[model samples]
Target: MMQLQAEDFGSWDNPALDRATWMDIGDNCGELDVAIHRAAARGDVAELSRLLDTPHDINARCSSENSALHWAIVADKTEAVRFLLSRGADPSLRGRGGSDGREGDDAALCAARFERVSVMEVLIASGVGIYSETLGFAVISKNMDMIRLLVGTMRYDFTDMPRLQALEGILPAAVRTWSLESVQYLMEELKYDASTISTNNQGVLNLALLAIFNQEDVHDQLVETESDKDWGVAIQIIQLLVAAGASVNAVDDWVARTPLHFALQLQYPPSELIDYLLVHNADVNVPNHMGRTPFFQLLTRSDATEEMVRRFQRLGGSLDVMDDEKNTPLHLVKRPEIASLLLVSGADPASKNKYGQTPLHQASCVGDIGVIAQLLDYGADIEAKDSSGQTPLLAAMSYARCSGFWEKDTRTINFLLERGANVAAFNRDGQSATQLIDLKGYHINNLGKLALKVGHHVRQTQDNREEENVVDLW
Candidate 1:
């Protein structure tokens, strides 16, 4: 649920809307340089010449401390920019940065943002300095002409202090555009390494692979009926990055999750994305920091495929890999098909998690009767005990008290009774299934009836066994 704004960089049509929403007429503009600023905005060089008597008037600050030069650059008035620069207008003044930005951008950065190549040329001629951040603005905005002016204007020793840092940093921002041109420009033209990481320790390849998810905090984009994400350009973007030397197994610093993990954890995982990563020799069962493998995440989804399980297994996916909680992938099985798949793939049905809960215990809590049947078929002990000494049947009964229709299924008790779950079983808490149901007014008539039926069945089976062992005089 980490809120991500990865698409905020490239979803803009107007340059002004993208960067200068802060210049929306703040307090105190009475002594405004209205005439000069208007002339610059109109690209009126003659009017600019007529109004300017000295440097004070020519470089006067307007809304947000933006000068006539900044206004002219934003308006794409190249000739007016030249006229102002001739009158000694300083191009280094920075306006007050809007929200979501730092202390504002310089005239050089502003021009780069609007893609004013000629105006930037004029600024360069007037001794205005370019920066690594300026190149960032050009790359993120997808302005090729501005990119050319900056890169071509100065043989910017791309290896220098800030330029190298800037180029490396732009890799993630380029990925944010979800556009090939943006990312390709950096990797191919600017020579930014495909392996570069953002400041948050996310590798470029990891960011690219995760672009299919467009959520902030809510995963509304992932609430799919049957995997609706197009991923046409998105997958290709990831492919391009991988081809450019991005590592397929790039792991994050936070959770140690590789791209394969992302593909598996989120819903509607693109088959192409999974196959592409596998083809690149991504570690098949690379566990996250908590020991949850991509395979573990895969089975959590209801849509897990047989081929997907086999593909991961063929690549060395471990079926019984235990997480930090000591729960194996099979221990969290939610579907009968998946349970059968994991069991056939060599999962340990009797394996215990940290709480001593087996797969049967987990199935009992969720009340998935199908999964219970599958686990029992695969040799899950019906009488298995957890740390509480609770049998699977007891675990199921206790879980019904788990508040409001969750963590226990009402249907499971019936199935377990049919499977002959022992009613004589008692947990370490000294509570049998019937005692548990009556503990806190949680007992319902249906469960009480089922409990009585199980007790009668147990006694009936005991009497049958006693009769078989008796001397048959007849």
Candidate 2:
């Protein structure tokens, strides 16, 4: 029965106004305030009754565009909201606050965000049901307590929402606000079961990756916690996951990569962690989603020296293995020192990736004349054609515009041409090298022909984009 004060009446846009004036007087008949007159915000009954007695509408909207009923419902003022409803206020009316008009959904979300359990209860009793937005609000609130209540007590389905399902690897934005007590409550007291983690769904590893990148301290803490377990806890977790019948060789279904692929890509993993996985017989040769084998990845680094190379070799890693593209380790080596070790260790220069292009094709494309010479010395094939029927020299020409090659590249070009690379060889399009160069507006030369090929690929990509013009910015 609180009285609406004089200050409550003012402009609807203003948050503070005289509540009594807004309730008792119509704006056209007399000056009426809106902001303070909101039933939920004012919580004043005498002013509300006075306004009801006047020609002024009981459900008049405030500056925020919310009717008095909308305000009371959102604020969880049940009695005030009920009184307004009994006087013919619409309980289902939407407000300017949230886009959704179902006052129940928006208010429940706000309540979850504020951690107002009582408010949430009152809203539920008033007929609000769980929805995607509310579930998301709970996660974004980082109120694990609220999530537990919603899931356990309210029987909300945790896996039903697509947004929640897509949140793999990314920590809830609100995780930063979680207290240590909250963390303990989730991991220990509630005994929340993390799914049997595989690389597919955002599993424990995905969480670990985000933690490592976003909040290093949390990552360090998790690492420390695992260190105390038998089997080097994390390693054991992975092992147990595999042993409990998770796929040890589960190549990433999307990229066909294995978990080992990600571990190696991290650039700085715990040495002990790496050693632990290796000791447990993790496949060092497993390829990832991109079809890149572990051995191929190791050879990609300029920093990998004799010792690292030797360790991998000693570990029985294959050097000639190719990814889905058939790219051999020997094909990508730029360091002469590493190349020497590779040959001495029996690396195959004639090996090809799925594309059927050999190490010589790769070396020439990079304009690495030194590597080219070394491969030739070891009897590498220069006339190899990929599935596209393009030769080493043709492939090299396609990339000539990317980097400046030494004038001596003519000798390599002439060598391949003379060795049957087909100076006039047409690609899959049946266009001769000369014709391709002419069509692309470049002079008829090896490099010029390569430019034409690049232009062709660009045009193809552009066409694809134009066909799918409705791009999602999000």
Candidate 3:
């Protein structure tokens, strides 16, 4: 005899049959009833019929508290399900020990989960309560038929705030599953407010942005490929929501990021989509919770394009907008091309961030020699001191020393020196650039040697100038 075990459940939360229930049932149940449970799970109509001929507990729950009807529905045993229902099996009885546990799911939920529409009809006709959680499961499953059955037949109040909240909980899942039809039904038929913000303060627009962001992250992990079907669905959903009056300016309550902020951060943001939002009057300069404008966010992305940057500019994005750190678009420049574009667009090269660090100071920290050169060409202060009193040259040397990328560091250091960085200047800690390098145990590199010689000459010149001033004073 092949005895069934929990592993036979296959992907079900509770794999093993409940031993205690089995033991109790085995002591009382006849061999025929046991065979009936097995027959129901396997969808053996003939075996079920043979067992049904004799007296049996039609709604007999097994060790897991799952009646034979639950088993039939879970296994998509349509015929067996009909027979069990005809025999007065209780469809409303909840399954006890599955993944969701005793209070989690009923036969209706199992039918919906497995997409057993016929079985679902039987359960619904038998008067099962469609709870909000059940609706959530259906929404997340993206089974339009099940969702329709629950909403249309069961008369679930889609206008109820609790139900709308439930729908919100599954928005991400719906997007992932490409449940466009289900979303349309909710928005069009139920008149669910597409712009209504959820308890988390995210509206449909914000959710769509989050979906695109997640898709981009997934794209990063996978090899480049063709446009995903889900991407198409996402674009369509955004279009549908926008046409239905979803706000393009909807900001998340927590991060306060408008949809525009997310659109610009996409790895390969669709130009048309961006333009659509802009045409709809999406604010390009609205700051988020971090006080970062969409333009500021764009600078943080290495993939930002000249055309994208230009579009924001033409739409009145301020080049000098500062983030919470007071870093302007120029201060956050990661690419030389972006730096050039910003400078041409009137970004002040000498503008300092909250930390008093100039664009040149930022370029040094990232070892972008090209951006450093570009800023200097535009007359950025080479010897500007940040709040810590570390000049651009000192910033470059400190970053290089800590980063362990000696070659790039050496190139950046040598570049700064040739561009008139003051090597003898001391930071707030009273440590000159050479002294800082010595503290890092790397006082003998090419840049270090140059700094020492330059420091001696600059210090001597400073002394001479001071003496000249003293004689004048006397």
Candidate 4:
């Protein structure tokens, strides 16, 4: 074996050697140095072995402070990694010499980054210290086995705040990936408390529910079998967490929303999970930060189902409960089924929100004839005025121009007219329904024209009745 001079190894300041680094290296290195870097990176065991025996510096630092072992591990070259470890390579060496003074990649960290469990084992066996960030990397890769090896077998301190933070950070990803086994290992075997681990200040249940909700949105559009698999995993994880004693009513600190609230807000809400949580004694009427209960949240979704409303009612959820805005569940009703369910459950249709708007007022705004009719059937005040002094008739006309559904809006206006909605009523702005229509420049179609004519006739008939009463009294 021929021994090379120190000068032949090249100075660290030499741009050729400096530019041939791994991640931090620029593409300005000489071809020879680049070839050497490539050989180590690609894990060409024979070539690396031949080069190593030539008195070349095995621990030569690249521009980014990465050594041959770091490159080998990053490339996932298990054989080259083993060979280098056996050849007295320092597994603990970190990359250095960057402008920002940032530490370079170590062998263990590199192995964890690429999720090479075998290489990680070899590095750990070589007495390399595992950083908290290494565990986070494994979690990021969703490698349950790697996580077990690091925390369970390697005995990395799980009590450390960084490790705990890493665990918390990965909970959402675990839920998103539907990694029930990994979640179970973290919660059960590792004793990670699901209640304590939150993503964005939301507990594990909240995170799981949000994940399910998002997956449901995608599941609705997908026609394949795999679409349901993710949702199924989410459901299982929710069940697993509950069975493991996770708090079903754990409220998100930011929104004060429980898992049930999230479940209700989904486009295709999961009834099974809702029922499961309720069975576990999750509060059916727990008020969120805005004072809205799960029932209130349910009414906000356009696809609120009759079965969901019935489930809540069966669970003893109160329909008349009001939020901070004083809006009852009935005030937010967008679907006829929801309205009907509330009515059957003894909800007050005439209930006024903080805005003094009744359920009928809200129904009129949306031009939902079914909900409007149901509210009326339940004795909702069609002429009821809100705090703004706007009646349901005026409310319907005011909102009609902005609703974009001209036909639906016209039908709602005409329905209110035929049902004796007082179109002559004025709001607090001193604006009557007809005045508002003209002020807003609403283009009323033929149906709106008929409604106006019928409204005028009704008002005239009322005036005539008053005159007749006065003559009789005289």
| C-alpha TM-score for every candidate | 0.77, 0.52, 0.75, 0.73
TM-score of 1: 0.77
In model 4, state the lDDT of residue 160: 35
Ranking by TM-score: 1, 3, 4, 2
Assess each prediction's global lDDT (C-alpha) against the native: 0.68, 0.52, 0.67, 0.66
Each prediction's total of clashing residue pairs, residues at least 3 apart in sequence or on different chains, is 0, 22, 2, 1
Alpha-carbon runs more than 4 Å astray in model 4: 1-36, 42-65, 83-105, 158-173, 191-229, 299-308, 427-431, 438-474
* Predicted model with the maximum TM-score: 1
The sequence of per-residue lDDT tens digits that candidate 2 reaches over residues 1-474 is 233333342222223223223233333322224633454555566677677877867667654445675455434465665566457664444444333443432445545544555555555555544454554456555566665565445543333354334233123222233233333333332232345433443343334222222232222122223332332344544543333334444454444545555455554545675565566565778766556676667677666567766777777888757665667778788776777778777888877777787888887777676677778777777666877887777777666645565444544554444334544666776766444433433323344335434443322122223322221100
Provide the lowest-lDDT 10-residue window in model 3.
465-474
Instruction: Please report, as a residue range, the 10-residue window in candidate 4 with the lowest summed lDDT.
Output: 465-474
Compared with the true structure, what per-residue lDDT tens digits does model 3 show for residues 1-474?
A: 224433343343322224224323233331224556789878888888888888877777665566788777766688898888777777667765434444635676667655667777766676655556566667766667887777677644332345555555656556545568877776654364545634343355456444544444321132323365445666777777666556788776656677777667655667676777898899998998778888787776788778888878888888767878788888878888999988987889988888889989999988888889899988898888898889998888767766988778766766777666766788777878656544543323344345546554432122233222121000
lDDT of 4 by residue, 1-474 (tens): 121222332233323223234344333321224334556776788888888888767777655556788767755677888788787777768865356775655777667655677788777676566666677666656787788887667754442345555565566566665677877777654354545654543454455444543333321122223435555667788887665455788776656667787676554656676677788887888997779888777766688778766777677777768988888878877788877878887889888888889989988888888889999998988888888888998988778766788777767776786676765688877877656655554444444446556556322122233322121100
Q: State which candidate, 2 or 4, has the greater lDDT.
A: 4
How would you encode candidate 1's per-residue C-alpha lDDT over 192-211 as one tens digit per residue? 45456443433544555454
Could you tell me how far off, in angstroms, the CA of residue 1 lies in candidate 4 after the best superposition? Answer: 25
